[model samples]
Target: MLKENKYCCEDHVDMAFDDFLVEKETFPCLEKSEDSKCSYCNKKAEYVLKLPS
Candidate 1:
């Protein structure tokens, strides 16, 4: 599944999943805003995943 999505094994799956959910909630603006940054890395859209269609 990950291979089909072009995700590397080292990528954190959980983080990617969370990013996907966020993206779905906010379609046009997939980047995490100042109010919605990752607690661990404080990065916006760093660990993004392509949701399954």
Candidate 2:
């Protein structure tokens, strides 16, 4: 499903997958300071967790 490709938000922004990986690799388990929005749609993301573990 979406998890396989590393998508988090309901909108499934392309950058979400890449951002998740970068965040995990660089700063695992770190909390996000701000909300994330979908790049393609420019809407508020609906990710279960703002920051991926």
Candidate 3:
């Protein structure tokens, strides 16, 4: 079951699903950036998973 949307860190503050898509689309090279750390664990977000709504 899906629980409430949970963010691991403040970087994802107020970010919606669409926002994630837009960010991914707009910044395709973010994966190579040092600042692209995971909002929860501070690890690198090497991949993005799109869950069904």
Candidate 2 lDDT at 38 equals: 46
Query: CA lDDT, every prediction?
Result: 0.38, 0.45, 0.39
TM-score of each: 0.31, 0.29, 0.23
Model 3's alpha-carbon lDDT is 0.39
Q: Residues 4-35, candidate 2, lDDT per residue (tens digit)?
A: 22324555544665576665554223233246
- Strongest candidate by TM-score: 1
Q: What's model 3's lDDT at 26? A: 33
Candidate 2 weakest ten by summed lDDT: 1-10
User: Residue 37 of model 3: what lDDT?
Assistant: 53
- Tens-digit lDDT track for model 3 on 1-53? 43222232344433534455554443221212333455457765443333334
Superposed Cα deviation of residue 1, candidate 1 (Å): 22
Using lDDT as the yardstick, the better of models 1 and 3 is 3
- In candidate 2, residue 29 scores what lDDT? 38
Best by lDDT: 2
Residue 18's lDDT in candidate 1: 55
